[model samples]
Target: MRSDRDQVGRRIVLAEDGVLLREGLTGLLHRFGHQVVAAVGDTDALQQAVAEHGPDMVITDVRMPPGYTDEGLRAALSVRRVRPGLAVLVLSQYVEQTYAARLLESDGAGLGYLLKDRIGDIEEFAAAVRQVAAGATVVDPEVIRQLLRRRRESSPLERLSPREREVLALMAQGRSNSAIAEALAVSEAAVTKHIGNLFTKLDLPPADTDHRRVLAVLAYLRGG
Candidate 1:
């Protein structure tokens, strides 16, 4: 069960330029008990709405009105500068490694980077929102895969057997060794061996053992 602090719904302000997605997300979140304090289509209104509503969270896209380059990202950064604790969940239609890095660089609570395409899974998206609002990090599975793929291309993983690459992909998807084994119809011991081999070839640090998986992917994404 969630603690009282979490059970209470958060006030959310949304900024998505796509009319249908913006409204659809608003409705979904509202159904989940979160308050839709404001929903707008442009950066100016988004910023203004945030100021006026003082929402607990902000769901936005990477691009919005005006230049449409990265207006939403810029707006989120501005919000962070003024209200350091505000939760932000950014939705993007495509992978922008740089944009994801910028949000991660903030080092703030309630940070999220998810693709809008996944909005079809209402429960998953809602869970991400709640996770971020409660001060957890949530990166989209696709983004993680993209980041990992970029890294693997240059690394010695290029030498791994095709089967090993498949195992690594499942691991990159946040699956455990046991789960990967089950999915691949292999033994957990085999999965463990594959992971060790991959780690050794990649020369990733052993420190923060629990987080190194994501870190490894992030490093790859950053072209490390």
Candidate 2:
């Protein structure tokens, strides 16, 4: 059994339009030893909360406030421009690849784009909270599925073999080497080989300081 308390309490600012879900998520965060400095119901208030609190991370809805189209996402992007490298986790009712692409345009680190209803496990959500706050990228699997369904007519990903592409998609989901192997029912060594191949194909050289695995996924999201 994995524990949800694998990290210290992270300061968070939540932006959700629904009253019930906003309250529910606040309580959920509290259960996992987190502090929600502010929970706003609109884009303007959300930006204000970020500016004032300077929270360690923000969990905001993709749609918020009067317009309720992409206000929350746009605001998140705006806030990131001001506070570069700020950890953000945007929750969405539907999977929108454009939103994913737009969010990852600047930096892929410390980011999360998850569906509202697909977040079924409390422990996993807590883990995602920790991962994003710690500068790791955690993308929802459905988003990856949608990306996979797209025809890679011409892109950097065209160089990758089908297996390498499979490995890359799992990486986008933030899966570990062992987890990827288990998911694919293959050996860890095989997963590593596929990862190396994809990285080479994407021209991402190995760097101890750089998250090449995430960069590969970002490449896929960008134009692959």
Candidate 3:
């Protein structure tokens, strides 16, 4: 793993409704060598900060003031509309399949959704920030597990072989074929074969640019 200093100096805009957490995150970002160009506490202010600063990344809580029902996530989505390809990392206290699905509906590049509990691991949190800024997708493992559990009873994913299911779960964690193979103690060719089979079973079409792995993960989350 690269040190946080390896990806230093990224400009970030942070949005969190809680004052203490916001301050703590701001300090943490600084300690990790990134600049918090703006740190706001509400959806409106968050959008304003992103628009005004045009930060490299936006780190926001899933809920925020003024309804607090996914306002922060909504605001992040809106920012993406205006600034396509902008990196966003949403933090949530719990896994919400709807929220995760909505965020992953399009290309998953430059997107991340993580549990707030991950903040306890500073190195991991910093790594997620760097990954998002570098145009990689990152989703919490627990989020994937929760989504799978919720749809386990009648999910099309049930059609998958155990190894295929394992491959899909690793894909949901944003692992590449090589990484998944290494984790599973299999050859890259085997991992690719499993991924191809899973894509066929899931009925995902190949795209020129969009990642099939991300689409497969989205399909899994949607219970397809």
Provide TM-scores for the models: 0.67, 0.65, 0.67
Clashing pairs in 1: none
**Model 3 residue 22 lDDT?**
95
TM-score of 2: 0.65
Ranking by lDDT: 3, 2, 1
Q: Residue-pair clashes per candidate, as listed?
A: 0, 0, 0
Which segments of candidate 2 are over 4 A away from where they belong?
1-6, 151-224
Tens-place lDDT digits, model 3, residues 43-158: 89998899899998999999899997899899998998899998999999998888987887765589999999999999999989988888889999998887777668456687
**Per-residue alpha-carbon lDDT of model 1 for 1-224, expressed as tens digits?**
86676667899999988888888888898899999999999988988999999999989999888887888998998987888889999999899888887888896778999998888888888888888899999999889888777766756657667777787678678888899999999999998888777676667657676676776565444432
How accurate locally, in lDDT, is each candidate?
0.84, 0.86, 0.88
| Model 3, position 69: C-alpha lDDT score | 83
Clash count (model 2, backbone only): 0
Model 2 lDDT tens row, 165-197: 888888888889999999999999999889888
- Inter-residue clash pairs, candidate 3: none
